[model samples]
Target chain A: MTVHALKRFDNVTELAPQALVPADTSRGLSITAQGLEKSFGDNRVLRGLDFHVPAGQFVAIVGRSGCGKSTLLRLLLNLDQASGGQFWFGERNDAKPDKSAVRVMFQEPRLLPWASVLSNVEVGLGDKRGTPEGRALALDALRNVGLETRRDDWPAVLSGGQKQRVALARALVSNPRVLAFDEPLGALDALTRISMQKLLGQVWVDQGFTAIMVTHDVAEAVTLADRVLIIEEGEIAMDLSVDLPRPRERGSVEVAQLEGRILRELFRNSKAGEDA
Target chain B: MSAPAEKFSNLTQWILPIGILVVWQVLSSIGFIPGRVLPAPTDVILAGWKVLLNGELAKNIWVSFWRALVGFAIGGGIGFALGLANGLSRRSERFLDSTLQMIRNVPHLALIPLVILWFGIDETAKIFLVALGVFFPIYINTQHGIRTVDAQLVEMGQTYGMTRGALFWRVYLPGALPSIFVGLRYALGIMWLTLIVAETIAASSGIGYMAMQAREFLLVDIVVLSILIYALLGKLADSTARLLERLCLGWHPAFQKR
Candidate 1:
């Protein structure tokens, strides 16, 4: 379950030089973390961890429940302060993480039930600051997600997949440099989930925003991520790069092999815990 | 759920009330129930017609309507403001909620004598009484609503960099509205009850006063007519609140018929 074991894969890709350059000159903030640690009282959730996500790179973090994968995402999101660490955004070594530059789509759509579909997307722009121009942007974002037809519908009326699509639209409407997905597709049906994964991949590729997805679904990570980080305990267990090209086929030999490897890593840690 | 079954169910709803009215009317017409005890439907309608012709009923209805409206505005407005203050701020809740809770416990009716002493039998006393009665439900419901807004949604709002005012308007207020409407509906019922009790106890004009005046003369028809008027007014208030709830909370799952 070490980085050395992950190096066995022949298809493992190295960071491309172009990815290091910001994809969108006006947006796309790169992330760097050094000895990141988070604790609630004495129980440390994320013990000292280091990683770098190049601008616009799609990285997925996979782990068993309570392995601090989500905590790491939250720290990167600045939703919670890290107990100890140096986390910076962009190329600058001292750039403080900006809230406006980062947006997160949660396990639930989290659309305001009181707002219309269009208004819900407009919420991504942050409150009353959403002018007519913002509304047009929101509409365009919905169009990107293929939910423009449901612009006036209530969230309650939307199906689970549709709700997640709306949430995706909301997340992208602000044109955030970084988009964090906290198991956003975990709740969808099998068919719906696959379609959504494709939609998400297409959107991410087109927008060229840095994506950090945390998921229990190892296969999903392999299918969508440019690189997959398997977290064991509070640290990164395996940081395997997926050299596979875009529009990855489901149940392909390579994807299945990567999925098996990640699952094995995940199960080994749990088995070790049980032994303890 | 089918169309024919839905039609049947709708029809069945009116059957019981119509049946009761028929039985009551038959019994009263036969004189089995004395007119002195309870007037028949015909007698009540006749008395209502008499009042209508003289414009007495319109005058009394106007007087009562204004009192309820003015009192509700004062009480409901204060309740809503205080609810928001306490709901949104821990400091305000700690300072004000206990005092309000203590005041809420004393039956608003019990303060009628004190209110009369302070404001006399003028419109002020009745309005004050109604205001007192209507405040508690609105305040309590508003607080509960705001406190129970989905934590996840609030966190989402914060992550989106919404300002305090924006969060309150976009998240807190809409989340609290359904509960606030529940309080308003409850307050409307209490508003009428308080006005009825106040008018009956001491008042120069209103439906309650007309009923009281009728009772002394043993005019059962007029008394019955007044009670019906009170029922109609209560229904009117409730329907108005419900309509407002429908308009404001169209996005609410419960209100989404389809």
Candidate 2:
């Protein structure tokens, strides 16, 4: 599939209702990427990618490893800049200071081993510089994640699931506009993954933060996402919406159908890459 | 069952030292060891008490302790600064790390001949020697601690919008403290060892000099007493370090588990 040239959308007003706004103007960040291009030396990672998740939407991005799922997530968070194309948060362009309102959780529960579980979450508070406000905010965040009891406990003592829960607590405590997950539950066992998925879905619903999760699991994409955007060859291959109601079931016919469609697209994408 | 196991281990710990003392005391009582070469523990204790009462032993001990303290402060300060510089900057590390490593390989003691020549066998040479001895272990450990910090934590810090300075102070320093502490403990050992050696040479005062004098006079009891003093001081310094490590790194997972 040929990568279309990245179109730089000059102003937020030019796009449709769901077009991403520069966070400054919209007072919210609903991520939108259009013709996003990324390459590592000679290897193009993301090619002319485009998608939009309205505010408070739970979007799951699914693709095989090396299919640029993580690259896209990183792009949205500004952890990395795309080589070409325009990505917007809310309705504004990329230059706004409002980008601080975004946060991310990685697959590894990257809690500071030397810090207590509470302090790890409080890292999202970003620089107490010895302030009472920082401590209060950190405590509030720990309480939100239901980990206030383990606040004083070191992260090393936490079980794997508990560690991830602490990480989730950390992400939420910041009260970010957008929470991006880069395969957060990919490392978990089947049972833990299911519970975490349920917990995540409930948290997203309650918090009302626009969340974009990158996953390779078809069922996870179907069960959690409001829309599952499948990437093939570094470009979005399918942009299918999941109209399934809240408290989604993994075995629901709609979920199974969506999962099957994603799996088929994944296989086809792999073959296409192999042929290339 | 567990209580017996605990008692057995505790017994095992003390057995060797107790056994050695018993055998040594028996041999001394039997007169199998000459007093010129070997002194009984009781004789050594009596000699220690005599020196203490005369105030000479206390003065010597104080002199050596102060020297080690001053030297440790100076060398450790410079080592920490240089290590942080090299650790943080790849260019600085590439330029200086090899040279530092090479200098580290040259035993600080080997420089004593030149050091004495330069400083004329006074307090300066001993202090400089102690400083040099303490520098390497602290520097190497500090560098390792900083360099080996988890990259993921750094990235997390960045994502949270932490300033570069905040990143270093909060994430980097705490992460590096354990390795740095290890270096400090090792450096402390080197400080005492170097001070003793420095005091051994050309010193009118201090423990090593007094021990040398005792050896010359064939005062075996004083010699044994001085050696015991060195061991005790070393042990004291080590315990202090361990205590500090526990305090500073108490939030660490290892301590939390305990």
Candidate 3:
């Protein structure tokens, strides 16, 4: 029975792409948030927040703590319902949340520690097939992240960097329409963080999925994202498109200028909020 | 530095037990105690062999083993049912938890006389006593296991849109397995202990009966041999439980890393 499951799982590569966008559906990417008011009791977190992502866009959200950057991501994922706003997926009507096309990578690796690297990746496949076929697809996903050799190894045995790689493999396995990264590399050390930043950019370029990342780091926003969206007080304060070349350097003049601008906007917002 | 050294290092853990056994055998041989009151190690071995040759010891061992196994099965089944139901369902927990806790406070050994009166000196009373003794530990541990599953893992399952049944099977059961195994091992140990006590009090034929019969006849060697058999059997049950824990929780973080 497990061998049959393995065969079925291996067939994911053969299965027709379920995410084939309709040719006539000109509306490729749209995220509508209107009257998006959220509150934990009396302290309102997000107030009338709104944003949109065009087709195949790389958007990075940068903000200080308690500016509701995380909350905004939660709203976007539909993990938590908005108090008043209607959130849509790919220009779909707000009738219901179609989370089938969305994949989220949390800040924590959140890899099932008991599972092998291959099986963990297969979790993204859902009930698309049985275990073995899912496992084969999982192996393929691991290959994409250069972790094929460690397929049979348990999550506990993997290093932090390797675990995050496994997490990336898991997120990408199902081929979701939008890959939502919730500060996915925030926990890594400085050296590993930069390396992962490069990996993220490469994966984003290869996969060509609409990516939305939430990060506190301005350089990260400037380095990887096509457009940097600075959110302050549950509002988009700055949404600037990065006109820099591929493999943008952190110490480069243009990237530094952009990072400074974003940081200034964040500081100004924080001071104003405090005074209010 | 060499193969012998490596072998010795690997076998070092058994040194204390071996030493204790050797000391015990020497003390018995050197007339450290009277033979009638405390039979020599060799006399105990001779008595064990004599009973084995006569088939008396084997019959008694089998009888006790079967009783304990059956009683363990019944009590473990009921305990698991109650534990899972109460652990998962708030309404069930509210209704059953207080009552089970109240019952758990009553000692199983204390209930032996009442049990004998209620069910008579037949196998039913002995099995009942064993089952009653084994029940609480398994129930408490199983409940603890279910309660201790990571809420984050459950949320992840929910986000994946798993059905309630699927959630129970995949997330809840596997997550609770380590704790449940702990309870299982504890209950298994209790099963043997309770069986011995029950058999000594009322059994017609068993290791306990042999020990009691030998005591009456003043056959110190047979009594000592019977005690050895009991100890060996208890060790076997414990080792089996440990092996099962290793098998079942092979994937757990603590076990996997080790």
Best-performing candidate as measured by lDDT: 1
TM-score of 1: 0.90
lDDT of 2: 0.81
Q: Write the per-residue lDDT of candidate 3 for residues B100-159, one digit (tens) a residue.
A: 999899998999889989988889998898888888988998888888888766766666
DockQ scores of the candidates: 0.78, 0.58, 0.35
The positional error of residue B25 in candidate 2, measured at the CA in angstroms, is 1.5
Better of 2 and 3 by DockQ: 2
CA displacement after TM-score superposition, residue B104 of candidate 3 (Å): 2.0
Model 3 misplaced regions, further than 4 Å = A1-29, A94-99, A131-133, A269-276, B1-10, B256-258
Better of 1 and 3 by lDDT: 1
CA error at residue B225 for candidate 1, angstroms: 0.9
Residue pairs clashing in model 1 are: none
| Per-residue lDDT over B46-143 for candidate 1, one digit per residue giving the tens place of the 0 to 100 score | 99999999999999999999999999999999999999989998999999999999999999999989998999999999999888888999899999
User: lDDT by residue for model 2 over B1-258, one digit each (tens)?
Assistant: 488987897689679878998899889989998767788888988999999999998999999999999999999999999999998999999999999989989988999889978998888999999999999999999999999999999988888888889889888999999999999999999999999888887687899999999888888898888888898899899989988999999877665423
Residue-wise C-alpha lDDT for candidate 1, range A1-276, written one tens digit per residue: 111111111122321222222335345678888999999999988888999998888899998888999999888777899999878878898766556679999999999999999999888876434688777778777776667888999999999988998898788777778899999999899988987876676566556678899998888998889899888889889899998855577899988988888777777756566632
Per-model chain A TM: 0.87, 0.84, 0.85
